[model samples]
Structures are given as C-alpha cells and as structure tokens.
Target: MMPQLRTLTMMRGTRARILRKICRNCPNLTTLQLHGCQKMNYSLLKYIFEKCPKIEKLIIANNLLADRQYAELVSRLEHLQSLEVFENRRGAGPVVLRFLAATCSKLREINLSCDYHPLEDVEYFVKAKRDTLTSATVRWTMAGKRPGCLPLLQKLDLPHATDLPDDAVVTISRGCPPLRHLSLTFATSLTDGALAEIHRLKHLQILDLSGCSGLGGSAVAHVAQLAALCTLLLQYIDDLTELQPSLRHVLDLKQLRCLDILYSGHIRAVAFEEFSVRLVNLRELHVTYEEEDEVFYKNVFAEMQSQMPRLRIINTFRWTENDFLTDYETDDDDDTDIGY
Candidate 1:
C-alpha cells in the first residue's frame, strides 16, 4: 500500500548483502539510510554509487564507513544533497566537514560526530556560501579544545551529549542566526544564562537540555517560554525532579507533542503521571529507569497508545529476535532452563 515510490531507506538493522541487492534494483531511488548495517563493506558502497546513480541523500549513522571509504564514496556519488557521517572516530569533525564541503557543494544537511583534533579546517567550510546548507550537527568529545562547526550552522543537534561548554553555546547563538533545533544534553558547563542567548531562533521547534546536571529549575523554566518549541527531551537532569514544580513557570506550551525524560533519576512516578495529565496533546513520551515501576511504564504506554493511536513501533529491550541482538542473545540466553 506504499505510495508510488522514488526512495527506500533502512535504519536500525539491515543486512549488507540484502542492501546490495536492493541497490542493484533501485537505481532511480534518491535516498538511502544504512544505519547499524554492521556487515557493510567498501565493495557494497561502491556498488551503490555505480548502480544507484540518482541517489541524492546518504546517511551512515553509528555504522562503520572509514575515512577512505567515505572519500571514495563521495568521489563517486557527486549528486548528494544530504550526507551524514555519524559517530566516526577516525578523523576530527572539521576534517570530515571539509572533505564533504570540498566534494559535495549541493549538500543541504550534514550530521558529523567525530573525535578528531583541531576544527579550524571545518570552520572554514561552514563560513563558505553554500545556499543549500540548512541543517547540520557536529559533535567532538576531545578534551581541552572547542569545536567551531556549531557557530555556522542553521539547525543543530547534540542531544544528551557530554563535553561541549557554555562559551560554545553562546558562539552558536551569535553566529548561527537561523538555528531552529538545539540540543544541549550532558553539557554540565551550561547555566540558565546560556538558554537566554539562544532564545532568538523564532522558528525553533525542538529543544533538548537533558543530562545537564548543573542547571537548576530556572533553566527548564526558561526553555518552557520558547513559543515555537514542539519537542523537548529532558533526560538525566538531576536538578529538576517534579515536572509540574520545575516546569511550572511556563505551563501553557499547547503546541508541545513530544517529551523524553529517560534516566533522569529525579522523576517520581506521581510527578510523571500528573505531568501527562496536563499534556492533553502529547503524542510521544518516553521515561526510562523505571523498571521497578512497571505499573508506571505500562500506564504511560497505554495512555500514549490511546492518545496517539498512530504509533507504529515501540522497542525497548536488552535482547530480541532482531538481528542486531542475535549474537548477544545467542551467547547469554540460558537454553537449559527452558522446559518448553
């Protein structure tokens, strides 16, 4: 029942061999997201470039696409509009950015998470006039250094991430005037002061301030004032306990639909229940670390499913029949204890 298709993409878990077969057939397809494809090799990627000549978007998140492999792929597929090299540890963020900037002039979005040193080269590309460039995400976890790719972005995401500082946030607000989605998770250095600066993005839709254990209730209060925010992720914020109390200052964000409070450690079951009652329009909500409170998760899930009947998938597990967990499950499951 799918619509007349021009694209097919896969995420979570997709075998490389099957993907290669698909690539050979779908030459006219324009987008491909091969995330968590562990068996992905260089030959398959090259085959994609050779067969799928119309591909304009490619995403390889949390997958293994080495620097040389990426360079080779980029060199072959010159018609890409969006290129993502997520969670790569070989090169610096700037180095990868510069490489993409050099190869793909039509790139509209790039999400790079790398651990390389020195970001000056990447910064240069950000300043370049690429009219199509709109969405970007850059993360670097090295110590005693600041990455500069954030300042020149229009849309930014660093959800629950550690290591970036307050000055970097300020620089981003000052430089990237069109920023609409900002995530400042695990940024222990941030304070209430940082939120005030980035409030100028009138088009802002998504905001994440999870894992920022340093900020107090005031920071959450400040973010609630963002008029255009629709999605908010507030996981691991040790300071803010009760949602109604901490986020009481701005309780009238009627446009809000999604909220994530995973591993916050401070959220009480009662507070969560009360908060959900107020969110009449919420379509998606996630709160983890409540396994002991199975009743809470079940109730929340029930409420979510009832309110947002359009939900298609919900996955939370240590191991399942899914191929990604096949190896782990095979190694750990106690088969001898099973009477069946």
Candidate 2:
C-alpha cells in the first residue's frame, strides 16, 4: 500500500476491482485522472470519492456517468478545485450545474467542452461561481442571453463555438473585465464588429482566433489595440487579405511574443519579412504555405531568423490536434496554484 502517493492516473482498461484496491491504498491522493477508463461506474466512483477525501483535481473525460450520477459523485468531493469531465453519456444539465454552484464552493476551474448542455445552465453556474472561477471551457449553443459579470474570471475558452454572435462578444467583454486569456477558436461567424468588442479586454494576453473566416485586415487592426497581448493565433482565417497595410498596426504591440498564421495564404513574404523585423520581443512564429510558395517563405523566414537570432520559426504542417490539447491541459493544471 502506497499511503504516501499524491497523484494517480488510470488511463484505460483498469478493472473495477483493481481500481478499488488502488483507491483504498492511496487515501492521501490529491490528483486523480481516470480519462478514457471505460470500467468506471457509480458505486466505484462513490467509493473512490469517499476514499480519496483530499482530491483537489479530478479528470474523468470520456466516462459513462449520467447527469444525476455525475452531480452526486462530484458533490461528495468537497475539496475538489479543478474538474474536467468531457464527453459523458448524458451531458450535465441544471441538476449538475446547480449542484456545482450551490455545493462546490471551492471549485475554480472546469472544462465541459464536447458535452451537450444548454448555454443558459452554464451561464447560471458561472454567475453563481463568478467570484471563485478563474478559468472555464464550455460549448456555446446560442440558447442563453448575455451572462452576468464575472469580475475574477481570467481565462474563457469557447473552442469551436460556431453559434457565438457579435452581441455575445460585446456582453462577454463587458462582463469579464479582468480577462487575461480568451480563445474563440473556429467561431467563424465573428466579424470585425466582434473584434472591436474583444479589444475592450485590455488585459488580454493570449488570444486565439483560429478559423474565424469572416474577419479581414480590420480584425488585426482591432487586435493591435490589446497592448498586453503576448500570443496571437490567426490560423485558417481565409479572408484576412491586404495584410501588409495592417502589419504596421500590429507593430504597436511591443509585448507580442508568439504569432500563429497557419493557412492564412494572403500574407506575402515581403509583408511577413517587414513585420518580423520590428517585433524584437517575438520568440515563436507559426506559418503554413502551399508547396509552390514554400521556397519563398523559407528564404524569408531564414533571413528573419538569422537577423533576429532569438526567433523560432515553426511550420504548422508539422503540428497535430494533440499539441493543442496538451497545451490547454497544461494550462488547466497550472491554474491549480491559484488560491481559493
């Protein structure tokens, strides 16, 4: 029996009996991840929660817990601070969310993406936990109105939120004033009007607008207003043309460190070279080009790297979805240090 064990992860295929033994043995565990573990059931989960009373971070992604069972199971963990329970059999509804808002006073971070739930229920939970929650990841279904103010919220990730609208961006900007990190990845319906609202988040550091095809050069112009921005992702923005003229606007962001422009073919080599020269603080640059334009970008990037000596030019073609998943997971883990 490893009584001193602090963290345990059972990735998959662990039998119920083995899990019971492990949980019984590791009573002092603080972080337990059962991602993709197919054998989990209500009785085993109840036993594990009772045994691991000190757990602060729990990840049960791809499990088979029903909404009520998940709510009941989580309510037992009074010390839980961070949770990631994605792609469950039945998505959490008002019962689970209300339970979290009312009982989980220590909960700080939650990721429910890929789960089917109404936007209004999530809004209620966020409003109730506004003072404690710093980071949140949820799917947007366009069924809710503007959310209430979340004064302490810092990071809000709505990846692949295809139904997000301009008014919602305005509402979010008005609500989350101290936001530092915002990811609206693949929200293709957003236009420059939404970008205008996003610029209101003056404290924003990392902004990912990947796959927002409705935006043009004006979007960059709006992003340039965020003086604190460190990382900017514009991957798959097909309409962001006439970019050379707007490159000058981005130069105002002296703190910009990482810029991703993968699959944005409108950016010419000359414009990229000109922009790269002035961004002295830039450390990483991600770009992708067709086979025909490969040599052109290679020469430009090579010269830029030679001149800068500290820049890392990455080819987006080499990256996979797991890369992003790992990054987001790491971010969630790091946020556990925030005091409740």
Candidate 3:
C-alpha cells in the first residue's frame, strides 16, 4: 500500500482507470491536482473522494463539472483546507459555495474563477467561514453592498474586478485588518482614496496594483507607507509623472524584497538607480522601457545587479551578453526569464 503518497498531480488526458487504481492504493493522499482532465466524471470523482478521505488540498482547473456534482464532491472532503477551481464554468456557483461554507468547517483557502453571482451570496460564504478562512479569491460583479468583518483573513485576491469601487475597498480594509497579501489587479475604479484605506493594513506584506489605471502618484505614496511590505506590483499604472519627488518615500521600506514597475514609463532612470542603491533588502526588480530607453535601462539593470549581487533584474526584452552571465544561464531562457 502506498500510504506515504500524499500528493498526486494528473494533467490533461488522464485516464479514470489509472486514477482509480492510484487512489485505491494511496489512501493517505492529502493533495490532488487534476488540471484539464476532461475525462473526469462525477462517479470517478466520488470514488476518488471516498478513497482519499485525508485530502486537505484539491485543485481542479479547466475541467467540466456540474453544480450538483461539485457540491457532492466537496461534501465528502471533511479534511479539506485549500480548494481551487478555475476555468470550470458550471460547477463553482452559489450552490457549491454555500455547500462548502456549511460542510467544510475547516476550509481556509478558496480560489475560484470569475463567475457572475450576487455579491450577497459571496458575502454570506465569507461571513460563514470568517474565523477559519485565511485566503480568498472570488471575482464577482459589484451588484450589492454589505458590511462584514473577517479578522483572521490574510490574503484577498480580486483580479479583473473591473467594477470594484472605493467604498468597497474601504469596507474590506476596515473589516479585514490583518490582511497580508492583497491583489487588486485591473480594479480600474479604485483611486487614491482606496489606497489610503488600504494603508491601514499595518501587517500587509505583498501588494499588487497591476493594471489599475485609475491610481496615480498618491497611490504609490500610500503604498510606501506600508513598512512591512515585501513584494509590490505596480504594473500598467500609467500615472507616475508626479511620483519622482515622492519616490524617496519608497526607500523607507527597508524590508521590501520584490518590486514590479513594468510599463510604468514615467519613472526616471535616476530614480531606479536610487532604489537599487538604497533598498538594501531588495532581491528582485521588474521593469520595462521604451524603444529609446531600452539600452539605457539595460545598462541600469546591469549596474544595479553589479551593485547588488543578490538582486535579479527582469524585463520583457531579451537578455544581452552584457547582462549578468550567471551559472544558471541556459539557451531555453527567453524574455520571460525566471531568476533563481
């Protein structure tokens, strides 16, 4: 018996017969990832769920499952803690969410794809799991408004939430005080006021404001106030012309490790130099430059890497010979390079 087999990942085209055998043998399986496994049916899933009663983390992405099937599957996993269901159109609706909230008392992390549902339903689930939930990723339209608190919640990712407003942000900040990782990617309606409200999350560590077109320099200024921040993503934020002077405020974040400023063309080279020099704990820096500034930014990255040996500079452009010639360099490394 493969009792020690705690994790299993099945890619696309996985056969149900093989899964059945594996699950039967691995009774202690704690984590299972079935990505793009189109062949999965309710009967097979139910069999696996019964066999692997110890599953604590389950990721089912890009598959097809109905709402009733989803509810049935989740009802069996009494030990479930982290659940992620992405790109599976029909399964993750109000019925499944409410069912999970009621049955999965130990559920802590939930990441679901963008689905149209009443804001009240989402709020109900959040309220139900408030004490146990630590991380949540649910993208719903802003059709309703309510005030609720989740004191134990740490991470909240609301990517592509186009209609997210300032008042909603205020409510979230005031409610979830201990939030550490907050992602508001493409939350276009948010402005400086929202950032001001988010500043109150004293323990915040990772902040992603990528694709947030409405934010300006003041937003950055508010972000700079979060002393505990380690990773900051400001990609696609076009308004940074007035940020040059207040850029000094960012240097105050002594614990910052990763900073992404991709497509933020307004920040000057001198400012980048200052950041590379002053931010002692910085380990990764992501940036993009215009056609004319390509060579200049390349040189700046090289210089930054030279000064901070531990720092990894990333950009959309291909790495040149003049860039850091590290031992891990390989031919397969393309523009979207992953640094060690």
Residue 294 shift from truth in candidate 2, angstroms: 2.1
Give the TM-score of each candidate. Answer: 0.68, 0.83, 0.85
Per-residue lDDT for 323 in model 3?
A: 69
C-alpha local distance difference test of each model? 0.61, 0.77, 0.77
Better-scoring candidate (lDDT), 1 or 3: 3
lDDT of 1 by residue, 63-177 (tens): 3444556565765676787777666444333344555566676777866655442456445455563345677665544443443444435677664456566667766666666
lDDT of 3 by residue, 6-51 (tens): 9988766567888899899999999998866457677888898999
Q: Tell me the lDDT of candidate 1.
A: 0.61
The most accurate candidate by TM-score is: 3
Any runs in candidate 3 off by more than 4 Å, and if so which? Answer: 1-3, 61-65, 89-95, 116-119, 242-244, 318-340
Candidate 2 lDDT, 1-340, residue by residue in tens: 9999999987666778888898999999999888673566678888989999999998875334335776677877878998876674543433357666787889999887856555677778777888888899988766655455788889999999887887788788888989999999999788778877777798999999888776655667788889899999888765456444564676777899998887776556225565556688999888776666668778887898888888888874433355354434556546554321
Pairs with steric clashes in candidate 1: 92-116
lDDT, ranked from best to worst: 3, 2, 1
lDDT of 2 at 50: 90
Clash counts per candidate, in order, are 1, 0, 0
